[model samples]
Target: MNIITLYHGSGGKGTHELIDNIFYKYFYNKILDQQGDSSIINNINGRIAITTDSYVIEPIFFPGGDIGKLSVCGTVNDLAVVGAIPLYLTAGFIIEEGFDVNDLEKIAISMANAAKKAGVKIIAGDTKVVEKGKGDKIYINTAGIGSLRNDVNLGIANIEVGDKIIVSGTLGDHGTAILCKRQDLNFETEIESDCNALNGLIEEILNSKLKIRFMRDITRGGLATVLNEITNHREQGILLDQNCIPVREEVSGVCEILGVDPLYIANEGRVLVVVASEHSEKVLDIIRNNPLGKEAAVIGEVVKDKYGRVLLQTNIRGTRILDMAEAEIIPRIC
Candidate 1:
């Protein structure tokens, strides 16, 4: 039987055969080929950045991407937002017993394609199979390594009152798309997940020589949570112009129907960038020119306030306070 079984994960002949035939065959690289207890990688001269993430998005397959592609992009974006050039990635897969070998091959191919698109390599990986009922169809974990630019110094310490906040594009697309597909909620327009690698777009911004204070990918708690975190300890507060924020019509509709705030919804491809006010326009222009950032906009700015907070200037010329999500709105959303 070609299906994965307990024997395949038993650390014996079956395990070796599986590694030699499938894993090594697809993710072959000089460093990974060595197959030592740990992978040996060359040290970078400058600062090195490392990040890890796990993907357990329900359904495994979704409208725009699958768990495999998401795993690679998730890690790559994490490294990239910190002003790093992603170099290599290590993947760990957990598959359920009796899973289809053909589906596994498809996922492997998807991971390879995503890594190629992001200009990174999958240098190492591990595979394990669990009992059929003990696991979902599959789960993936990835770790990424990148080299940081010596000239770039980005962090909360750099954030100042007057810095502008820019979001890469529309919000909540990924979360809405996943929710719809998972619940079998049909809409006239099919919403696809905005699952993409943002390293290229971020690279463009970095090349423009803008003074970016900090950058974060809106993932779990969405933009609101990210903004709150950034302003938590600082004396400065964030003032967001609600009208300036970009939200897709379909995504907005889904959120309204489900009573979810787009600001609190997750996004896989969107980025929250804070730059000095003087360089905001140039930064916005650079982001707009990129395919992934065509809808980029300056949504808000940092302000001097007694208490660290996030305030939203409503469209009707009123203001309201926005805070971090008190509870989980959506779960298992990668």
Candidate 2:
């Protein structure tokens, strides 16, 4: 069929055809080829990390990546930040009845390529078709499994005064790109989404055996929400230097025009790292050496005063509270 139909989800002839032509064709692997009710993964050692997320991005396709790529990366990063080695992924698709078959194949191809690059397998998946207008063109849900590192112990409770707050790269690229695309805003330079898998980058730091207090992937709620969430009800507060936070000129300009705070903008590829002061410099050096972390910087520190608060020291040397985002600034942003 040129376009998805309800029959494709009936678990009969049409369903088999759809699975064989697209899902099975692209996501082929030894484990997936078995075609069993569930994938059997063995030889796993140490603690296991599993994360699941649903992607309903407004536009199925975006600047640097699409919803398919976003689904895999989002799930993988969730595991990576928890100090895990990502190994397998399961993707589920919900396509509108009238969705284009070519588009579906493109998305499947993107997912396959992304999984390959992330060194993970798409072991199993499910697909469903809904009535036209009952759903968006497409939506994706993914679950990732990983093995936790025995040497690494990370948590917010480990945060102590004088610990450094490091962001892997500039902020707001992903949110800004989605906004510009949805609003049809034009600019001198293109603002592409920073969506990417961070397992490799995270592994590099974990391999160093540094003293990491905590690590989190910068996603939906952005840095502001993450900082506020971690510092909330805690003995130690976090103080951020406005000038120290890395932000691309293009992103800053976009935020200014749109009257949006970059700190509240979502980032898919960036990571927030908290490490002891002594190991901060070495951690920064290691992050900077990687392509995904070239713009990494120590933006803040845990403080003893202003407990349970996130304070930002502005470029003008004035401090202000950076609270959790109360409302959604942009919708359907992965």
Flag regions of model 2 displaced more than 4 Å.
Answer: none
Tell me the lDDT of candidate 1: 0.90
Predictions in order: lDDT: 0.90, 0.92
lDDT of 2 at 223: 99
Per residue, candidate 1 scores C-alpha lDDT tens digits across 212-317 of: 9999999988999999999997799999999999998988998898888989988888999999999999999999999999999999999998688899999999
- Number of the top-ranking candidate, with TM-score as the measure: 2
> In model 2, which range of ten residues has the least summed lDDT?
322-331
Off by over 4 Å in 1: none
Candidate 2, residue 161: how far the Cα is off, in Å: 0.8
Q: Per-residue lDDT for 22 in model 1?
A: 70
Residue 81 displacement (Å), model 2? 0.4
TM-score of each prediction: 0.96, 0.98
